[model samples]
Target chain A: MKNEWPLWEVFIRGQHGLSHRHFGSLHAPDAEMAIKNARDVYTRRNEGVSIWVVEAVNVSASSPEDKGAFYEPSNSKVYRHPTFFDIPDEVGSM
Target chain B: MDKDLFQYLLRLGDNTLVLGHRVSEWCGHAPVLEEDIALANTALDLIGQTQLWLGLAAEVEGAGRDADKLAMLRDIWGFRNLLLVELPNGDFGRTLMRQFLFDAWQVINLGRLMKSSDPRVAEIAAKASKEAAYHVERSADTVVGLGDGTAESHARMQAALEYLWPYVGEMFVGDDVDAALVAAGVVPDPASLREEYDAFVGRIFATATLEMPESRFTHKGGKNGAFHTEHLGHMLCSMQWLQRAYPGASW
Candidate 1:
């Protein structure tokens, strides 16, 4: 419909220190209603400690043609892996 | 047995049970998907509260009937919900308007109940109060938004407010039952809640830019079990049909 409510992307933080992860999207008339809708749609099962909603129109996405530039380059960077580091016995599980 | 307390708990449980069912009727029929989910969530919260309230009521009655039995097996006169709650959900705006009116009263009533002399009553009130507070906030915000929005929405919300206004009084009309509860400190007199309800609703109406109806006339009798609007009987037929058809059925 031409007058449909705007779509909003929802992000939910599962715990106090956790970063919010994208959960889903829903339509709302405004930012406030978007948050309320996200709470109802995403957090009913104790799924989140917090929520964030962004308008779908305001999100910037990389195009499929730019996938190599945006993502493929990172696949070959073995030096970027933190797994190569060794810890002293005194440093324990770190 | 405390007959007055049992009656009061039925009033509490039945309000949530009936209103929850009414809200659930919008499950797949709301104006939009998000709203459908939101309304369903509201209904679920009310139904959860119903379980608590009615469970306690059943215990107080010392009868074999449980919450499910009290909720599903009861006839119209057995219900003690406010007439406001049992009224049909006219439209989306009207449903929310009815919700707002009920939630406003419930938030205050539950707030007072948190300090009830009956410990079980206090415990249920504490949990239900949180949900009622959230319900009133969302419903009030929607009322203001729709009441002050485009001409069409504003007009519809105004009409909704007018239609639901008279029913609001039934929530605060105290009688002998309230007197006994008040004497025992189990509940505050319903009449005492009027000033706060008016102030809260007045501020909301002012912000919504919707005029409150000037008339003070109220239709009563639902909560006392003296009478109910025809809507409650029709609602029970659908709600109770499954249990009626297959007695003691459960999933």
Candidate 2:
């Protein structure tokens, strides 16, 4: 029997998001199924208007053990924040 | 207060309630987590539709009954649901096949019902048609997927189609309950819907790559208030337990 359907990582672009954001993962036989599953799983409550699915195996990840060296160094860089820039009220909501 | 209109509403309402209840049976038993939720979603729609149809049916009955009482307290013989909805869910394939067939007909039926002379019938049919449209798409897609999948999947779907095809006939069997309603323009004749139903179901079957069975024999009598299946009794046993145990309990 063909068991253990592959896992797919789902991404959704809601009414508020400009880009798709990772929502969750589900098991399916193929990309089509992953899309359907994603809709049923993530969008059942009108959560998103668009969806993207990637096979879990295709996604590469850095080791969690390297968090201190990989991500922590970026935490020290507050200059990346848009708040660091001076903007007049004329810029409006931005 | 028209008995014919009341009977028509029961036929419509019971189909949704019974089928909704059947779909709800998949709450935690679907093949996958997504399906469990999807089927449950379908169930919720059916239940809501049931409330609308049965609630109106109660208003027509004029015996001081509500939707809850009409739904929970009725004896099996009093129910007017089509046999197809009351049949047990055999597997995911069977469940979906049954849904596709029913939705195919429902979408058309409700579309016509929207134009009903009676304001209430038209109102309910309008909302239901929209949901039925979505259901047709979802179930049709699933049918294509399962029918064209692996050999095992294809075989299972074919079996489901063949097994349930017989019950589909009952959806269109018309008698006095349908006659008066059709004459009054409260509802469309079930016979008139056959061609359209077959066309939609045929198209889906083609895309799914499944061959249509040659069986001409069909099971009927769901709308006649006499169900020949044991499935409804068992289903109602659990469905009515709480209502029977506590006459007026509320959550």
Candidate 3:
């Protein structure tokens, strides 16, 4: 019976002005139950006001194994730096 | 016992005790493992609240007793909780509905209690109100979702509301204890809670696209020392077993 539903990732917003952050994942019968389960499990301390539960399968992410090859070239691009520009003493802070 | 204070504390304690037991019943039987932990967590919160309230009740009565003793030894007639908290958790829908209703009432009740003239009661209410606020929001969200979801979900949600509706009235009906608390400004009048509770629940139900049931047959008894449900006996047996079996036993 438990196998009937899929896994979901829970994201929670601690307050009205805050962004939803990843809390944890849980198995539930559906999206609705997933949200309730997330609230019950993660927000019992009054930690969240808003919640978002997405099917785990629906989220896409860059693979950890591809990290080095995917962005190593960017680290060597010193020419991209704008440090050569000069600033007036009158606008010293800028 | 100072009948007024005793009854007041008993209501608070009983509410937590019964609700805690109801939530604990889901320990190993939740629909999913994550929910098992979730239910257990809620139960723990209620148990903690019960201890604080019952402990205070013991003190006010000058009974050289403690929370555990009050919880473990009390008979049905001694409890003063609302009937709503003792009802069986029929399903996920029913449980969520029950929680939603109780949490909604608690937020208002606790918020008012936080301003109580009694410093101790106010302090406890202030702390518990924060937790109750979260419980209300979480359960309200679930209530909305289930009520607006698929056909099967809608049916279950409606059934859950129907099963639990009769007990809703008991929540705001004041007895002698409540009346005295109101006069003393230690608690707000129960009648004053209705409009706010209705607005909060109404907004959620509207957003969920669920029609509110209009039946007005209110069930009242648990607070008056009458028991009409089978859940409490089983709940007390499990909750009190260790204490009863080994009197004075401690970890």
Winner by lDDT: 1
Best by TM-score: 1
TM-score leaderboard ranking: 1, 2, 3
Provide i-RMS per model in Å: 0.7, 1.5, 3.1
**Which candidate's DockQ is highest?**
1
Q: When only chain A is evaluated, what TM-score does every model earn?
A: 0.84, 0.74, 0.74
Model 1 chain B: which ten-residue window has the lowest total lDDT? B1-10
Instruction: Output the lDDT of residue A17, model 3.
Output: 93
Model 1, span A1-94: residue lDDT tens: 8888899999999999989999999999899999998888899899999999999999998899998889989999988988887867898885
- Screening candidate 3 with a backbone cut-off below 3 angstroms (N, C-alpha, C), the clashing residue pairs are none
lDDT tens per residue, model 1, B1-251: 28899999999999999999999999999988988988999999999999999999999998888999999999999999999999999989999999999999999999999999999999999999999988998999999989988899999999998999999889889989888989999998998998999999999999999998988789999999999999999999999999999999999
Error of 3 at B74 (Å): 0.8
> Across residues B11-119, which tens digit of lDDT does each residue of candidate 3 receive?
8988988998889989999876876887788788888899889999998888798888889888667777888998888999899899998999999989999998888
Clashing pairs in 1: none
Per-candidate Cα lDDT values, in order, are 0.94, 0.88, 0.84
Q: Is the docking of candidate 2 incorrect, acceptable, medium or high quality?
A: medium
Candidate 1 runs further than 4 Å off: A74-94
* Chain B fold agreement for model 3, TM-score: 0.95
lDDT of 2 by residue, B79-127 (tens): 8888888899998899999999899989999998999988998999998
